[model samples]
Target: MRTESVELTVLCLIHKNGRYLLQDRIKNDWKGYTLPGGHIEPGESIVDAVIKVVVKRKKIIYRGE
Candidate 1:
């Protein structure tokens, strides 16, 4: 029997004034406008993963820093 591994990922939807935020991906394999998100790192919580992905992808400044 063969086994398949599952990977965990997260996606976030930011809505403001009836508008939603999306990312315009230019990579060859993933070229298109899509939601901003990424895979969760090992031992990382879902909330932390969401924050990290959003900040890294969108270049959002951390107000708590």
Candidate 2:
């Protein structure tokens, strides 16, 4: 039996206040202050993933270009 694995990442665009908001790997993965984005789950789009992470963390909505 092969165990499938999924990877999640975060990408952040910090402001000039020297404040960075990224993700961190927890266990055997790259669990650290990554950017402000993550992997896309089934049925979830790329933009959705980023928005979820950023809004959930910073409590603000972003209108990406």
Candidate 3:
């Protein structure tokens, strides 16, 4: 029997007016503009994961809905 591991990730789209927020990835492997997001931590909710990633990468804070 063989086992496979899966990783969960999330991406958020923040748009206002006619513009959307994105990150500029200058790394050699992946170089381009992408939305702010990252892999979800273990035992973390989807919403929480997205929030954490967004804050860490984009420096944006969530103020609740």
Candidate 4:
């Protein structure tokens, strides 16, 4: 059997004031309230993905590591 290992998606825990960002994954194998995430581009660092995908998508200015 052919097999391959790769980094695909990233989940982020973003909290503001008193709320945790989440999503309703209403498709595929995901069904319910789940953390926000998306596909990680090839050669992209996890930190960059978090900032570019999750943070940018939400439009929330994140200023901490």
| Best model per TM-score | 3
Better of 1 and 2 by TM-score: 1
Residue-level error in angstroms, candidate 1, position 62: 6.1
TM-score of each: 0.81, 0.44, 0.83, 0.69
RMSD of 3: 1.5
Which residue pairs overlap in candidate 4's backbone? none
lDDT of each structure?
0.87, 0.64, 0.86, 0.84
Whichever of 2 and 4 has more TM-score, that candidate is 4
- Compared with the true structure, model 4 gives a TM-score of 0.69
Which stretch of 10 consecutive residues in model 4 shows the poorest summed lDDT?
A: 56-65
At residue 21, give the lDDT of candidate 3.
89
Kindly list the per-residue Cα lDDT of model 3 for residues 1-65, writing each as its tens digit: 99999999999998779999898999989799998888998999999898888876678866664
Collision pairs in model 3: none
Task: Give the lDDT of residue 63 in candidate 4.
Answer: 69
How do the residues 1-65 of candidate 1 rate in per-residue lDDT, one tens digit apiece? 99998899998887769999899999999999998899998899999998889987678765653
Q: Give the TM-score of candidate 2.
A: 0.44
Sorting all predicted structures by lDDT, with the top scorer first, yields: 1, 3, 4, 2
Q: After superposition, how far is residue 5 of candidate 1 from its true place, in Å?
A: 1.5
- The regions of model 3 sitting more than 4 angstroms off are none
